[model samples]
Target: MLLERGVTDAELQAEANRIAVKVESIFSSYLAGSGDGRDRLFEAMRHAGLGGGKRLRPLLTVATGRLFGIAEDRVIRAGAAIEAIHVYSLIHDDLPCMDDDDLRRGKPTVHRAFDESTAVLAGDCFHDLAFEIIADTATHEDPFVRAELVLEMARASGPNGMAGGQMLDLVAEGQVLDMGSITRLQQLKTGALIEFAVEAACIMGRLPPEARTPYRGFARDIGLAFQIADDLLDHAGDEAVAGKRLRKDAHAGKATFVSLLGEDRARQQCSILIGQAIEHLEHHGEEADLLRAVARYVEERDR
Candidate 1:
């Protein structure tokens, strides 16, 4: 069962699950003490943010931070902030005007579970909360570090990043795109925040900008690999296990890595990317075992 460095696939899943639980708790605490007719908004936010996720971005944050001996709790808080942004994006992405998904994580999406307006508000609140958490001293003791986290996270989630990618995706619908265009879209839409997850750790660890090049490279590779795996999953993955409507990309006429590249070739490319990702960590020791395991998990994950 051992994958590498005494880490197993099951162990990676367990850790992801554990991070999910911890993130749920953090979300609960933050959403608590809400009053004054905001209960429904809070409820919708909880429905969107609380349960059922891989928490991969947070895991990357914690794993990379561990390389510098950062306290787990500190990194977990930062990771939770990143998770909030992720949840916010998902909530909006599932709206009627967006992907129009009804199911997510084995249940009705926020818009389906609640109402559209409530879902929009919930997503908005989660976006606000992400920066609030990162800005607070509780996430990091250094004011400079907190500011940097906020700036990087904002950039990752802003127009030049996820939002821009989403726009590109919407525009690409029904249009045939070359591999370069698809790669650019995925890099912005999916890869940016993923890269930020690792970058946040380096920032917290006080690693110089120059020293973060390898980690950045690792993040970029894994981010693309993760999206390719997702496209493959959409191509043929089971809906029941994915807990969401599958084949939406194909149905929407969106060009994905799988759509442009054959499934076999996409899988092969994913393996290559993952290999490159792990090689980026060659300078590190076993302290990076979790990251290596994460890269493998990204390649092998079914959902």
Candidate 2:
């Protein structure tokens, strides 16, 4: 019933894109006034963090916050913080030591466009900046809320989460990973931050922990589905549209859901997960329509 609401995918995308632009401006201004003319570092940071990608994580933050009627500006600030970490991860993920990617979001990888050292520094800067942004008083009126946001983000990005998953991924290369291991790897590498994106809204809204369970479910399922879709894209997706290289996992002999389960089975599983993800939003009513649409879009996207 709520799906019948007039909100369109285009509208959601527009809002998300708008947030992306705004965050880029905010981050750029911060960098400009930060210190001496260390212009190259700032340029590298801007290159990686600005003007690209789908901005899905930030959109999730904004969408979830909307469900609680949180201030749009506050949500945008949180989204910006989340996105800084995300972009930082991407910069590192594309490094020669990591994925060795030469292209990302249809442009040269930071390492490829700049230098390896500069790329590393840029990622490190963005990582630190994410925490600084979230901890700032401007992000929330309540100091406790800001502190909690910082703690949660640290947990999401640190050893128990993204970093741990990346370690597992590095290990999996040239080794066989069971489905369980693969699932765990993806849950940490991809799902943890996504979980934070949605859950942070609850913190920002001052919602009880109980209120996050459904959204958490939604994030977990969709996060996996999103990765599965990504696997499919890598399996046969066009590099031009994806704005990155494809089939690298196979080349590296890495394990992915698509590799473990065939295309047909992966598609089926992704659809099933999307169904589960959408069900989690029923309690949110029409306010979550955009999130529901996003779950479907994740599976259907070409890139």
Candidate 3:
């Protein structure tokens, strides 16, 4: 299917990798100018921000923005904001009080690489920096679009979105949750940012909700598929390639799509979700080829 549109999976991967590099550079440059009295916090921020990850959210933002003919620089700036917020969440999530993770992106987590206090400050700084980037007029000439982007990002990452979901996850620890409950949990925990990634493109383009509604649906399906893939990877994926601890959910006795649906069923559900996600893009032209490949790649990716 990807080949028919002249968009190969490799090409899509290459595009995402390119975006990752761009975002890393943006972050590195942003932290490089830190003055005295806070160099360690900035260093921790650079470590967490520039360290390798899939940068999937930024890719989604950039790809969707490109579809609307937004300028590459503007979209890349927005992508950087998305990645900053994401890395910030990762830093906090790895804190001793949180997930207590020691490894991330094949290196020691921010807290492990630096002191816990510095890691906390790094996460806080990145969180603040995300909005600063989006709010800057340089991200968009129009003030309204920049404001909308900031507001959307706030909702996506604030109590109603990722943070709220994390709170719920903390409370639900070691407790059995039903499918509906778990779905809602994962939607908020992981899906909110993914939704923001796609919807931010609409804001970047100054497009109305009616125009970007399909992409929202696309984000919804892909978000769940992405979580399911994560669960599957955690269930059986190699920790070396995954670059973190695997089977933590199972060990913690947390219910996941893989645990609840079984590996085969969870895999089948991912296929179904990807199909639906692709369906939402039918109204788009070949320009949306990258999104289609992204959907397929999420299903097939090993890390």
Candidate 4:
């Protein structure tokens, strides 16, 4: 269903790589201040933030923006901002007090790379930097529109959204949860950000209201589907194959779709969600191609 936009998975990945490198360079430039603490901070930040992710959020932003005729450079700037925010979340999530995870994206977690203090500050800094990037890039032409992007991302990233979801997940660990609660937590924790990524693109691209809503919904469902696959991978995946340790969530007593639904059923749910996500694209006609491919890949990606 995807790739109707004349781009292959390999091509998408290539574009993602170029954008990723550019994003890092921009991030590095932003961090160029003279001080030992700054150096330590960047070391921890780069340790966890640089390289590894498929940069799917930013890629979605770029691709969706193109659908609305937004300039590619502007979309890339928006993507870079969100990707940085994402990296910030990961840094904090892996802290000793949070997930307590020692590794991520096939390498040592930020705290392990540097120290807990540095990691904590680095994460905090990155989140703020996200808004700066967005605001800086979006300030001209339509200031309100550009500012709206920051507001949407802040809401998604803040305590009422992703952060709140993380706190809920922490509290819910080892406690039995109904399907609704499980789904709600995952939706907020992960789906909100994915929604932001899509919405950010739409907003950046200046897509019409009606079109953006459905696409953001598509992104939300895809995010949930992607999380389900992640939960399953943790149970059935190899560390090397998955690029992160397996069975960590289980070991930590983290409640997940896999634990609640079992392997087969979790996989089934993912398939169903992917179907729903693709169905949202039907109105796009040809524009839906990239989205459909991305939805499928979310379900099937190994890492």
Candidate 5:
């Protein structure tokens, strides 16, 4: 299969690294303070929010915004807000009541580093901060744009999206799930925020809803592909490189794409999805090189 090419792995990593720095800086600024009784909460927030990861969601936001000629600074702020939500989700996901994870990004999980209550509060604060950043005039001057961003973020993170998918995931433990059920579970748990990342750019660009069909297609495809790749990683990827535990799904008797389809078929499916995702960008030109690179990266990343 011939893939569209412009950006190299080094270039993509460089760009991701740059975005990571900027987003972490934003978290630092938002989290900076002292002399309060809530200092531990702030420290926990900083620990989780500032910890480095792929930062893929924010990268998508910025890359999509670039397609619309949006200002980089403005888009970066919006991306930072989305990443804040992502970090918040990770914090909660790692809690004892949730995934019960001990390590994240190769370091102690927030609950382990601090305490369970502090981790919970830090996650809550980050959730609130996500909306605070989005609703602030700094993200966008237009009230309507800010409002739309808030609405989408809420839906993506609320009961209908990530949280709902998580519920489904928990329920599926030790139960048999068909392909459709597993797909839907991942779409909500993983895809919703990814879709929001792209849609946010459309909102900022003021693109009409009707014209966003292709971008939506692109987001949906890559989102599923990303999750499949994650499942593959869990099935066979190196835990040291992944910076966390793997095979927990299998251990818990949860059905995943890799578990259902097996390794070869699952990898093929990811390739097909990445190809379809890039096809959605057919109308775009060189300016979309980063987005194309991202789609391929989603399929090829080790962690």
Candidate 6:
């Protein structure tokens, strides 16, 4: 597969390292450049970005941008922004008030690493940086377009999207939910940002309206697919391999794909979603291959 050939462990790690370094450098005003007020911004931003993960969201943004023949530098900037959004989500999710997670990517959660206040503030600052980068492109003729894309991202990440789903999760906690409600919860909580990611690239690249609709559909499917695969991983994968705590879903009594469908059927659903995700890519062929590979990678990866 085109995506399979492109994705490699070394490729991911190298990409993560470079993006982490670049994000810090690009946003260093908080740390290296300015007023005391900015110092806290840099600290929180760095705490999350440099904290470490696979950098999948950033890579997804970049890979999709490449579909339109966008320049590498622009792609890198956009990629870094995506990473910021993702880590920011993680920072908030790991809070004692949220997921209450102590470990993230095998390290202390942001709140644990610094303090609860710092973690909350860090997530907020990262959110600010994401818009800053996207909006800063106003010098370009397409600045309005880029700004719109960022707006879409903000909607997905904010109370209406990720946060909304999280609220539902909290309310539904420890309760038995029907499959439909469970899927809806996952779509909002886990899938919103991912859907925004693919569409963001499409919008930025200025894909034709005809093509953009398909990309939106593709994004929605892959978003749900990846989330289900994550649920599958929670059960079948180990903490050592999953890169964080394992079986936390069952421990927390959250309804997951595995919880509703059982491991075998959940794996079966993963295959179906992966297949559908790839099928969605067929319209764009190689242009969509990287995303196709990403869907496959998400399905196959233990972590």
Using TM-score, give the best candidate's number.
5
Score every model by TM-score. Answer: 0.97, 0.95, 0.97, 0.92, 0.98, 0.88
Give candidate 2 misplaced runs (Cα > 4 Å).
1-6, 33-37
Q: Which digits, one per residue and each the tens of the lDDT, describe model 1 over residues 186-269? A: 999999999999999999999999999999999999999999999999999999999999999887778889988999999999
Q: What's the distance in Å from true for residue 205, model 3?
A: 1.8
lDDT of each: 0.90, 0.86, 0.88, 0.81, 0.90, 0.74
**Candidate 1 worst ten-residue window by lDDT:** 1-10
Better of 1 and 6 by TM-score: 1
How many Å off is the CA of 296 in candidate 1?
0.3
Q: Return the TM-score for candidate 4, rounded to 2 decimals.
A: 0.92
Off by over 4 Å in 1: 1-5
The segments of candidate 5 whose C-alpha lies over 4 angstroms from its true place after superposition are none
For model 6, the stretches where C-alpha displacement exceeds 4 angstroms are 1-41, 138-141
lDDT (tens digit, per residue) of candidate 5 on 1-303: 236578899999999999999989888888886878888889898889886789999899988987888887888877888899899999999999899999999899999999999999999999999998888876545898898889999999898998898899888877999999999999999999999999999889999999999999999999999999999999999999999999999898888999899999999999999999998888878788898998899999998
Clashes of each: 0, 1, 0, 0, 0, 0
- RMSD per candidate (Å) reads 1.7, 1.6, 1.4, 2.2, 1.2, 2.7
lDDT of 4 by residue, 18-134 (tens): 877877776776777557657877666667667677788887777677667777777777788888888999989988888888778889888887888888899999998888888
lDDT for predicted candidate 6 compared with the true structure = 0.74
Residue pairs in collision within model 3: none
Which model, 1 or 4, shows the larger TM-score?
1
lDDT of 5 at 303: 87
Candidate 3: regions farther than 4 A off: 1-5
